[model samples]
Target: MDFGSSLGPIRPRRSGRLGDTVVTYLVDRIVSADYPVDSALPTEPELCEEFGVSRTVVRESIKLLEEKGLVRATPGRGTRVLEPPGWNLLDPIVLEAQIRHDRELKILDDLISVRAALESDMAAATARTIKAPQQQELADQLDVLADLLDDAGAYAAEDVAFHELIMVASGNRLGHAIIHSIHSKARLSSRYNGTPTRADQEQSMAEHRQIEALIRAGDADGVAVLMRTHIVGSWNRRRPEVHRSLTALPTVE
Candidate 1:
């Protein structure tokens, strides 16, 4: 009862109603696989058999994929997976296409935005009542940031823990909820890429310390400022970098 992916480079003419057929099969497969970015496409025969169509039908089907930048055919090399902009990852179809293709998930962008929103709210809540131990914990994390910052993966992990602590300091049920929605793609990405430069980590640690100081002073606005700076700063750092693989990133811890 499963329909094949009609979304990508299915051959036209041989396959009737080019767009619908291509979209159906293509969308189904991508959705099933979660539309990962930069992943490889299935063999032509696979699409043919799956779609209950001929090779020409499958060939035309993939054409649509090329238009979306979701796939390409190398003639003898068959098809390679691709997921570039305009794939509408925010759209369910593109998301599935990227995931299906095994493209690197656009994790950093989403995760950082979530952190900005969650941490900012957490900082505001903490300003109302930050406990003595919690304040010290924040300070300790800042110091730790200064120390083991040579390890980017560890630094990212600690960064997440630091932000999560702010949520805990808020002393509200919403804290846990925020953590659940907030993701750790940044940390996971760091781990995948191994460690970055010590200088990078040091700068990050310094930023955390500044935020901790603001939180300790019960300056919600100041904490908010620092949190925004950290989030935006991290985004700016990674914005220039490119990633490989589009899906199945380590779940945010």
Candidate 2:
């Protein structure tokens, strides 16, 4: 509850709102388990003093945390940290923190699993509904991706674009938004190694070409199966790197 030392120095942000700064500080502590679940958080006065912020800013930060399910503030017992299941992983701040914690937990494997499931469905749906320019766009993306096979950074960007285009073309706006959010967080995390080897790029390109062919042929079932296979295969190829990251992380007590 007393996170004074663990919370580190409270330097004011040069541009952002003080409340948001306080929120980031609290969210980081909560996710890192510096303020363990069910433990009482420092009082408003204590937080105010610690962050050198006003009661209003501290109060706003705690409110935001509550909205994200990171804590529950009781009238008399004060605020208490909640367990991971209690938190809203869809919340961007929480998602970022979750990915950070994932380096140790291998939570990205679970995320990839979910992504595979969603993308398979998205691919099938898009294949069913894809139109002229979008279909053409998907076809052209493969060529662009192939050309960038030697450029890891460029290939990664195109890889993201290729997948995002499918999701958007699926006409499932909500699904696209969700996948976009997932990729955004995952891309920022160290767990996602965006730089691929030449072989990896070639493999990805081949799978994508199959995906394009399936979509163009209107093979929904084939696209679904291939998409799932592609996702799992890609992750399997990088399993060693992922395993290394997991093993090297210091175990959180």
Candidate 3:
């Protein structure tokens, strides 16, 4: 195979470090299945030539790929692309690449399910523990969402803020951190944040108001149910129609 053509043009350098560029290009190839599972990556010298980077940079890039579980390096066998199950999906680079190549929308579906599960639990926690001031803050965020209903872009941004505030109020720092990392990267995908109509935004705002009411009333169970419903429902409404039949997305209990 013509590895250079398969990998496409070397990306323009985005930083002073050449290794980062090489790593990103190689990651794109591996995740896109340009280099399929168990396939050997181009030899170091070949990579160096293709990427126009030094052998040292190529080696470091391979090292980074290995660290991300995208490849395995052996002294005599060279580096081979690993199976998808082995990949460090949480790594921003890997996740972004996977999202780009997720033709079936399976990853995005799974992403929404995971987000719903975590955010629902966090919402429950917040409802149980929120004091008057925190309740007021969440109500204020709902007001912000209402104001942005006419602006899809701004509404989407504040939509995220409203969810994050609930996560923060939950006091589940680990859940909050996990959601923060994945949600930010997931938003980069068009499929994940599908274009929302004004009607869609209005529905979402109404749901947000319901969530805030449940939280303010200290109804943890109600909040959890509504939070999960809101998230999964929003995704269903905006989910791209192109691949709807390919696979059914998992549901949250």
Which of the numbered candidates is closest to the native, going by highest TM-score?
A: 3
User: What does candidate 2's lDDT look like per residue over 1-253, in tens digits?
Assistant: 3334545655666423778767876787788787999999999998888778888788888889999999999999899998888898888888877777665436678778889999999999999999999999998899899899888888888999999999999988887888788778878754576446799988899999999999999999999999999998888776644454343332211
Q: What's the true lDDT of residue 119 in model 2? A: 93
Report how far off residue 36 is in candidate 3 (Å). Answer: 0.5
Give, for candidate 1, the lowest lDDT window spanning 10 residues: 184-193
lDDT of 1 by residue, 99-169 (tens): 33333434445555766777777787787699899888888887776676666766777777887788888
Instruction: Put the candidates in lDDT order, highest first.
Output: 3, 2, 1
Off by over 4 Å in 2: 1-16, 240-253
Better of 2 and 3 by lDDT: 3
Stretches of candidate 1 exceeding 4 Å from the true structure: 1-28, 32-108, 180-182, 190-195, 240-253
C-alpha lDDT of residue 65 in model 3: 96
Task: List lDDT for all candidates, in order.
Answer: 0.62, 0.82, 0.86
For residue 23, give model 3's deviation from the true position in Å.
0.9
State the local distance difference test value for candidate 2: 0.82
Q: For residues 105-208, what per-residue lDDT tens digits would candidate 3 score against the true structure?
A: 78888988999999999999999998888888888888888888889989999999999889999999999998899889889777888899999998999899
Candidate 3: residue pairs that collide: none
Q: Could you give the C-alpha RMSD of every candidate to the true structure, in order shown?
A: 11.6, 3.6, 5.3
Candidate 2's error at 155, in angstroms?
A: 0.5
